[model samples]
Structures are given as structure tokens and as C-alpha cells.
Target: MRFATAEIDGAEVCGVIEEPFFHPFEDGVDLLEVLRSGELVAAGKRAVSRAGMPLDSVRLRAPLRPPTIRDFVAFEEHVEGVARAVSGTGVAPEWYAAPTFYFTNPYAIAGPFDEVARPPGCRVLDFELEVAAVVGRGGHDLGPERAPEHIAGYTILNDWSARDLQSAEMKVGLGPAKGKDFASTLGPSLVTADELEPYRDADGFLRLEMRVAVNGEVIGRDLLSNMGWPFEDLLAYASRGAEVRPGDVLGSGTCGNGGCLAELWGRPDRADPPALEPGDEVEMTVEGIGTLRNRVVEGAELPPVRPATARPRDRER
Candidate 1:
């Protein structure tokens, strides 16, 4: 069942399913409580609703705060293009030896359908569709074969990038931080790995259907299994000699040939670029997980909060 966390009346709450099939499990489940339980929330233990509120109405929060760690561009094509676009080269052999990443401020995470204002200094904003894995248990230095056991569930991650800023920092060999970390959006809800099993394809790829629409026009589409660097390898490699814990998120990087800018806009080191404007709305979706829709407004003020009493907690029957 899919679960979501939202803020109503200044208190953030976990949403569980009261029933199933209205987009998987619309029952309200508490994410933090479920992770800490060490066992899946027993079926019939929570409530769900299909006729629930529209995703646009709720105040979304990060699915998990203080996500253990964040990984970057794992897809060879996306990385190859990014490198050639900036440095005029292809994949670095060093990247394949071990997984790599940058630490994002977990506090900066916003929620699905929230309004994302353009950062004051950024004229170019981009959206990336990545499958994020949430750790269910903690472990360190685990081998690739044993990696799947540490997974908790999956959620949509928008690794929003500031292209102009990112291009400038890579010259120093130590960035994508100021460019990437400014605001990373996660959620709608965290769906346990067990729930994703049914969507798996014969090729061993999770058949998590995904699409991105800009201003109601479709811009991106692909299946989750097409990823070259699967989540299992990222987990195993990332935890090698390091500790990974529950509530941490690992991004699958932007899908190869699936990104609007990374693939469609250019061919190999030679093409024009698209810049995000003040009123553009970028919406990314993964079937079963739900949609993350955000509008680009002038980087000005954060949206106001909605009242608590107005949002009633629906419980499972």
C-alpha cells in the first residue's frame, strides 16, 4: 500500500491506506512508525481511502528526513552526456569502480505537488525522474549479493538541478552540491519494496511505469527496470565500508535517454539548451507510486499553511 506524510494544522502526520486499488493502498500509514516496527504493518492494521483528497490539496513533506545518504548520476548514458556536455569526454572508468554521491541537506526536501520557486540566482532549473530506495534496516560494508535485504521501499525523487551553477562547480572536482542540494523533492508516500513486486518484468526490471508532463503535455516516459545501475548494486556498493540506515534515500540517478535536457535536448556535445521560466509547471509521475506535480513561480515566498481541523484523519475499518 502507498503511504504519505502531510502537514495539516502545523502537525505532520503519516497517511495509511484504509483500502486498496485506488492507486494501490490509499490507506493512511505512518512511515516513521512502520520503519521502526522492524516488520511490515500487518494487513488490516491500517485504514485506506480511494476517494481521498486530491494530491494538490495537502502540504507534502519529505517522505524521510535525514535520509542516510544520497547517490548521483548512476546511469551511463546520463553521466556520459553530462560529462561530455561539460568536460567534452565520455564515462570515466573511475566512476565504475565504486558508487559515488554528494550529501544533500535532508531539511531542504519539499513534498509532492508543492510550489517550487526558482532560486534567486538560478535561471535554469531541470527535473530528473529517479527511483529512490529507502533503507529498511541498517548495515555496513555489505556485498552486492546481500544488498536487497537492506531495502525498505521505493519513492519518487526529483533531483532538481541548477545547470548553470552545476557547470561552474564541476571544474573544482568537488561539487554538484550547491547546484543539486538546494532543493530535492521526495514523496507522495513511501511504497514498501514488497508492494513493487507485482510490477517486475521478465528482464528483471521493476515495471514501475513513469511519465513526466510539462504544462499538461507529456515530456518523458519509460519503465523503471531500464536502469543500467540497479538499486541493489548502488546499495551494496554505497554501504561498502560505510553504514546505511533506515530512512536513508539512494537515487537511481536520471534515467538514460529519459531526461528532458540530458537526452532530448542534445546529441553529443553539440545542441541548444532549454531554460526554465517563471511560470512553468513540471510534473513527474511513476505509476503506483503517484504523481509529483510542482509549479515554477518566481523565487519569492514559501506558500502559506492550511488548517488542521480542516483535514480529518481517516482510519481503517
Candidate 2:
């Protein structure tokens, strides 16, 4: 079942997307509530037929708010490419030994069809196509053997970045913060992990086709099988020395040769960077996860920046 959280008439409610129609759940709100109550299908069905409710009239919001954690993992090519961009040579060995990431504020998360404002100081805006796993159960020092137990489902993530800010911050060893903290887009819906369990092969690699488009132009494509470390390993590694909890989201980084500006555009000396300008629309899609669409607006008047508030979950051993 595809689950989501949305706002209808100023109230937030959980929901299930059934094609052109959306079935909104009750006041409990959020994917965690639906999963914990085992009422996904029942509540979804009721919302579709209830009085004063219009399945086609409500607006969709990020499927979850206050996600316990948000992890960016899964793309090896992106890691190598990004690392290369930073070092001007080869990747470090340590990046492979552990699953590393920066935390994002789930409260600031946006949804499909929302307008994403470019930050005031940013001149280069880029979009990344990724799949993130959602945590269903909380765990500490989780082993690879028990990784699957903690997974609840999956969804798409648009790791919007300001190339200028990210480049400057990385040099200081702590950043990409102001660049990334501005906004993050997630949703369409969460596809439960159970429904996708069959897609994993014997080698434990997931097989999903991904494609990304900017203003209706295709720019990136790859298979989930290409990820050097699968979601299970990421979960295991992330939980090693830390804690993980329900409603957390672990992103599959930018896919193979699939990120904007960072991978497709040529080097700094040869050509101009591929960056988003005002009015550019970005749409990202994964096989099971639905399409995530956002329009870009100028950042001439962005408000004072706020850092991500969610704390890090314990990493897996």
C-alpha cells in the first residue's frame, strides 16, 4: 500500500494514494501512526468515502514530518564523483568504511508540486534523484543480520543543493550546511518495505529503474543494483554506534552519473556549470516511489537560514 501525509482544509492527515484519488486517514497523522495501528488500508478506505471530504480536493504534504532521522546514502558514483570534485584527485578510503551523512530538518520538508525557493546567495542550484528508506522500528547497535527488521518503507528525495555554498563549506571540513539546509523535497508517497521485498535479488541488491528530468528534459538514469552499499548495510552501519528510530529517512544519495551539475556538466575551466535558474521545474521518479515535482523560484529575498534540528541516529557497527 502507498502511504502519505497531507494537509486538507488546514489540518494534517495521513493518506493512501490510489491513482487520481487520495484516501485521507484520521487525526493520528504520519506514517508511524498508520504503521503502528495496522490501520493503513481500513482508514484509507474510509477517508475516500467520508462526508465533507473530497479525495481529489486536498493538497499533499511531505509524507512525514519530524522524521526521527534523515540519512543520505546509496550512490557510489556520486560519492566518488563528489569526492573527486573536492580533492581534485581520488576518493578517500574512509568514505567506504562507514555510512556518513548530514541531518535534514523533516519539518522543513516539502512535497510534490511545491515551489522551492532558491537561497538568496546561491547562484547554482542542483537537484539529485534518490531513494530513501524509512525506519519502522527503532534499534541500537544493529547488526547487518537484523537490518531488515527496522525498515518500514521507501520514498523519493530531492537533495537540493547550492553548488557555491557546498563547495565553500566542504573546504572547512564541516559543511555543505548553509547550501543544503535551505530546503529538501520529499514525497508523493511511501511504498511499504513489504511490497518491495520481492524485488531484492539473491545478492541482496534492489533492482529499480530511476530517471530524472529538468523542465521535462531527461538528465539522469540508473538502476538501484548499482549502489555499492545497499539499504540493509547502511542501516547496519548507521546503527553500529548510534540509535535509529521509526519515521527516520535514509536517502540513497545521488545516483550513478545521475546528479545535476556535479556529474553531467563539464569541468570548471571548459564549460559553464548546469544550474537551475528561476522558474526551472525539477521532477524525479523511481520505479516504486511516485513522481516528485517542484518548481524553482528566485532566492533574492530568502529569510534568515535555520539549521537542521533533527539529531543524528547512532551509526551501525
Candidate 3:
């Protein structure tokens, strides 16, 4: 089942999609409510029995506003490709010790068809093509083997980036913060794990093809099966010494070698694709999930950050 939140009659309603239309649930206005009620299928059935609004008649929103979002670099090719272009290096050895991730701002979440604002003062804006798992069941200290059941569904994730700001910040060796605090896209709709069962393999990886385009020209493509680790391991690792709760989102970072403009950035030998500017459209598609689309637009003005004044430190007591 594909669960969604859409704007109907200027009001947002949570519902299920049978395609060509979206059947909104009778009682809830938020998808999180349905998850908490533990009536996913029942709610969907109720929605389907009602009169559905035509898909084109309503506006789509992020499936749910996640409680937390952990974005991970799960593909080796994406890391290596970007690394080689910038530093002439492959992935850091530390990357192999474990699946590393960074907690991004959940409040910055945008929907599939929304406008993605380029961070104020940003020029090298880029888009990452990936998939994300939405936690359905909550758990603590879970093992990889048992983590699969905790995932409710999957959706397209676009970890929109400001490469220039990211590079400057990483020089301080602490963050991707302000560079990433702007926006990240998730949706089209949330596809339940069962809907993706046929694409799952014995190896625990989903065999879906992911592709991304800008203004209709294909920029990158990859197979979800190429991940260095599966979603199960990612969830297990995420839950270690912590709780993996419903509405928590886990993103599978950039897809492959050319998944983003960063892959072509700074490589004089390569024909660099132009960075995104206002009005540029991006579309991402995963074989089982529907297409997630967005347009780039000028961002709001950013107030200048004050520079630190040099001051003497206090003597050790």
C-alpha cells in the first residue's frame, strides 16, 4: 500500500493511493496518527471505500513529518566518485569499519513536488538520488536480523546539497551543518515493505533501479542492490544503544558515481554539469516507488553571521 498526505479542498488529509486517485482516510488528517493507531491496513481500507480525489486534482506533501532523519552514505561508488574528483582519494578507511550517518534537520523536510530553495548565498546546489526507509515499529538494541520487521515502508529521498558551503565547512572538520540545514525532499508517497517484497533478494538487498534527471536529461542511475550494506544493517546500527521509533527516517544517501553534481565538480578533465539554478527541475525514480519531483527556486535572504572577535583566553585555574 502507498500511504500519503495530500492537500484536498485546501485541507491536508492522510490517505492511501490506488493510483489515478488518492482515497483519504475518514478519521485522520496526519499520517503519523495512522501509524500510532496501528491501523495501517484498516485505515487504507476505509480510505479506499470513500470517494477518492483525482491524483491531479490534489497537491502532495511529504508522507509524514519524520521525528528524526539519519542520512547515510551506503554506496561506495558515490563516495569514491566524489572523492576522486576533489582529493584524488577513494573512500576513507573509517567508512568500512561501520556504516556512518549524520542526523539532518527533520524540520527542513520538503515534499516531492515542492520547490527546493537553494540555501541563501549558495551557488553550487546539487541533488542526491537515494531511497529511504520509514520506521513503522519501534524497538531498542535491535539486531540486524530482526531489524527488517521494524521498517514500515520506503520512499525517495533527495538530500539536497550546497557543495560550496559543504566544502568550506568540512575544512573546519566538524560539519555539513549550515550547508545542509536548508532542505531535503522525501515522498511521492510511502510504499509499505510488503509492496516492495517482490524486489527483495535473499541477500537482504532490494533489487530496484534508481534514476535521476535534471530538466528531463538523465544525470545518474544505479541499482539499490549495490549498497555496501542493506537497510537491515543500517537500522540495526542506528538502533544500537538507541531507540528506533516509528516516524524515524533513514536515508540511503547518494545512489552511485554520478548521482549528484558533486561527482563532476572540480574535475577540470570532465565536462561538469551546471549547478542547479532557479527554475531547474529535478526528478528521481526508483523502480518500485513512484517518481519524486521538485523544482529549484531562489532561496530567502540569509542574515549575515557575525564574525568572532579575537579575545584572550582565561588562564588555567
Best by lDDT: 3
Which of 1 and 3 is ahead in lDDT? 3
Put down candidate 3 lDDT per residue, 5-85, tens digits, no spaces: 898777778898888999988764578877766777788888899888788888999989999999999998888878876
Q: What total of clashing residue pairs does each candidate reach? A: 18, 12, 0
For residue 238, model 1's alpha carbon misses the true position, in angstroms, by 1.6
Query: In model 1, what lDDT does residue 50 have?
Result: 31
Ranking of predictions according to TM-score = 3, 2, 1
TM-score of each: 0.81, 0.85, 0.95
Top-TM-score candidate index: 3
lDDT of 2 by residue, 86-193 (tens): 555545677777767778666668787799999878987888888888877778998878998778788888888888888887788876677888787888888888
Error of 3 at 213 (Å): 0.7
Misplaced by over 4 Å in model 2 are 35-55, 266-273, 300-317
| Model 3: lowest-lDDT 10 consecutive positions | 263-272
